[model samples]
Target: MELPKVGSIGEYIRQQRQQAKISLRQLAAQAGVSNPYLSQVERGLRKPSAEILNQIAKGLHISAQALYVQAGLIEDREPDSDVLAAIRADVTITERQRQVLIDIYESFRKENRAGNPEAQPTQPAEPPPDAAVHRENTATPDSKEG
Candidate 1:
């Protein structure tokens, strides 16, 4: 059977643990894995198999399916509305700014959902530097003599 590439699974495990606010030693004891081993796994230097992943999932109190998707062991559905809303609501911005930003975001989202790139706004170009632009410039290879 196929296994997820080690690095992705490790990264995902680490992210989930951090988000859950679990300490490495605590989680290691809970998952029945050595702290050093779990640390290596979290750093993407080791790939634990399904049984171990299931243990970790149980310790985290989350579905193994979620970890599987993170590990790239399984395809996942798009996040549901509640999950998406929760994420959107977690922003540090004030509610009024969030609403305004959400309105702009939703407008583009509608265009994307409709498959209409032409409906997108054109971004403004950056301004050119004034005459004060100097070249204390770390000279690039392209600027040097052949």
Candidate 2:
């Protein structure tokens, strides 16, 4: 699927909402915004704040980073690994989990680049020990435990 161009966050949001088979009223209610406000946003008449965007992302059951990227709030990076792309595209995992994985992956890339500026970017970063307690008690949000 072709992504909406950057700065066209409204179009992107609308597309995602439609793709999810949600109506405008349903999305507005799910997103916790007024229907008129959401309509304005979709029509490009109003720009949504980060908080609103976050709520919309949650309502869409998608990674907030995806919205942020389309909103131009996050700088879109291109990595050759395809791992980052897959991570973002994965709908099975919770948004928080996706973010943690992305953070770890980017950190690894940064470290690698720092150590060898000429080295090509590669390797999917593994979750840190702290990120994995493997215990029910330490579960993060959306985890079975919490």
Candidate 2 per-residue lDDT, tens place, 1-146, comes to 65342356787778778778899999999999999998878877777888999999988887787888767788757846699878866655655687899899888878787887665666799888689555456656777743
lDDT of 1 by residue, 1-146 (tens): 65344657777677667767799998899999999999988887777778889899877765686567666677655455454355333434433454466567667777877978787656797766664666686878888988
- What is the C-alpha local distance difference test score of each model? 0.71, 0.80
The clash count of every prediction, one per candidate, is: 0, 0
- Using lDDT as the measure, the top candidate is 2
- Residue pairs with backbone atoms closer than 3 Å in model 1 (clashes): none
Off by over 4 Å in 1: 1-5, 77-146
List where candidate 2 sits over 4 angstroms from the true fold: 1-6, 77-146
TM-scores, all candidates, are: 0.49, 0.52
Model 1 poorest ten-residue lDDT run? 87-96
